[model samples]
Target chain A: MLDVIKSVLAAFFGVQSEANRQRDFQAASPWMFIVVGIALAAVFVLIVAGVAWLAAQ
Target chain B: MKRFALTGICFLLLAALMAGSTYAASINTSTGWNMPPGVTDVSREVYSLHMTIFWICVAISVVVFGAMFWSLFAYRKSKGAKSAHFHENTTVEVIWTAIPLVILIVMAVPATATLKKMYDTSNAEIDILVTGYQWRWRYEYLGEDVSFFSNMSTPRDQIQGLEEKGDNYLVEVDEPMVVPLGKKVRILLTANDVIHAWWVPDLAVKKDAIPGFINESWFLVNEPGIYRGQCAELCGRDHGFMPIEVKAVPQEEYDAWLASRRDAAVAEAAGADREWTMDELMERGAGVYNTYCAACHQPEGQGLPPVFPALAGVGMSVDPEQRAEHIAMVAYGKTGTAMPAFGDTLSPAEVASVITYERNAWGNDTGDMVQPSEIRDLLGK
Candidate 1:
């Protein structure tokens, strides 16, 4: 079970890692996904709030 | 590097799309979108706020796009560059988030202040009730004895490109909303039937006139000029044809115009008692019908199918009693129908003339001339 989880994680991250290898660059870290997701979610929330406020006006 | 290039391409494509869609006449437009006369302080503030935001957007776009393009070219993959391995810098993420938050805060403060000012409509100098119909605007100046309907003056021939376009072209109107300059004019907007938006970009105000609901806006123009706008909302097929033109004249001129209109209305009322010759009425009535009724009922009294019922062979035109009802419907539009009451839009003479024309046109001669006095009586009742 542990091995399967590791493989799944590797598959998700390793595809982009392989692409990076072909380009002779460092693989994108998993933390980048978390950071980007947080940023995008923040932007989406702000946009929705702004739109709602304007509609109320 | 590839991602940056893709973003750059996407931005360029979006810019081209936006540039392609803007109206040709709006380009090199010197005067701000026509501002109606008698704009209030709030409207002027809103206009200034809009310009401020627009300039801010332009500045942001220039900075952001400039940096993006510079970065793309400076650190492109074509230069055989190796990607930086350093990632997950907590400080950098915090900085980016903090900067954007600060920028939003800066933008929100003034916008909120302007918005708060816009909502206050108390102590208005002049109160005008504006009612939006299917494709026209009606105005009633409370306590001013000034009420009228404003319709698009652009000829169908010009609109259909059947004739040469005039100077104002689509922006002209048969009757414009006239207001005194340098006075705070308050407008209470409502709709007779469907939803229509009263928007004048120069005043930087657009509010939906919803049926059974009143929305308020105010404006005061510093200069006197003819300001034009269109029905911003899509109401129906003739939506594009409904235009709004406001003639803001000096206070003295406005007063004189108002007096003349009142006198003409009184004279028309008195003329109803006198017997009018059919030849005179028909000639006068034709012009009246063409201006007020032709937009929907049509020039030939053949209305548009599936919506506007035909007035030519209709029972309302043939029978005398039904003719009165037709006049009533035209004077005070029937509820739940496209027929708007012309009571507010047309003068007594104009209404009488149009009704007389409708009764006589298309082989349906009722041999009756609807006098302005009758309409005035009907309106009073």
Candidate 2:
């Protein structure tokens, strides 16, 4: 799970090494990455919205 | 020598950037260059956001073009350099995409904040319903019983180039929408005929006025001054003629102005009750005709052919027997035609006068006169 979160965060930034890409693709199922990516995306949106709300205040 | 050349290039770029910043700062007040840091807090924030994003783009372009040019010159054919064939280089692609994504996230932060502030139109002190017509704007103060139409005050001769144009040639209006300074003024926008946009740059309020749909926008003026804008949408032939003017005054002055406007509206309503003489109706009718009717029917009563029929000594005007038909045509316009019903747009007095004027003027002398009371009776008002 920790490795999956790390890989998803790297993917969110669009920055992943060749070794990491090979490892991620070699994994049996993409379900882990997919689930993690979606969860991280929602968190990213909440963080941005929170910052905006604070700045407006 | 190569290192020296690179250093010289960097120095030149730095100098150019410095000169540009100085020039932009100096020309901030000039209308030709850059967006104005407008009179309200939101407007100023918008301006700052614009500049921040603009500078980010400038920085990115500098780095990108610099690298591109340096690589181009350094690896030219003259230097015995050979091109490498590569596709889908993951590292380079990732770096490029990652940098842009990060930059976009940074840019979106402030923009979202400003957008939220702009959309928060709650607790506004004044609410005005702004309705757009074919070539005019009608401002109705909510719960204030003060409503009036603002028409362009620029003369026709200037437009035709027969007379010299004034400084505010196309931007002047007969009556401006007045607001109190330091108070939030929310405007509910809609259109009676077609889509039109109300835009005032100083207050940074621009929103569309669509038929059967109401859009909400708000502005709070920081300073007391007159700001002018025009209909930002192209609705019809006379789109360029409709202008918007907003005057921001102190609270007490605004109260006084609103009171005076209420009195004027009362007086105008009273005009409908009295018996108006022919001369009185004719004079008022001519003004109304020029403002509302002259766009389709020409100033001399000879309208454009086919699309707009001539009103002078022809059609319904000359036919004394078709008097009621003429009145009905003016009051409730002909369907499936460009002639819009002035029943809702014009007052009873105005409709009566224009009809009376069309019957009497342009040698269509039927010696006919329509009264406001008769029109009121016909409309059951």
Residue B282 C-alpha lDDT in model 1: 82
Q: For every candidate, what is the interface RMSD in angstroms?
A: 9.8, 2.2
Model 1 scores a TM of 0.71
Checking candidate 2 for backbone clashes, the offending pairs are none
- Could you give candidate 1's per-residue lDDT for residues A5-39 as a string of tens digits? 33344333333233333433343554554555566
Task: Give lDDT tens digits, candidate 1, residues B129-218.
Answer: 988876778888899777777778887799779999998887777778888888877899999779999877655568889999999987
Q: Predicted candidate 1: interface RMSD?
A: 9.8
Instruction: List per-model TM-scores for chain B.
Output: 0.78, 0.95
Over the stretch B71-148, how does candidate 2's per-residue lDDT look in tens digits?
988899998999998645777887788788899989998898899889899999899999999889999999998888
- Please give the C-alpha DockQ score of model 1: 0.04
Model 2 DockQ (Cα-based): 0.38
TM-score for each model: 0.71, 0.88
Top candidate, metric DockQ: 2
Quantify all predictions' global Cα lDDT against the true fold.
Answer: 0.73, 0.89
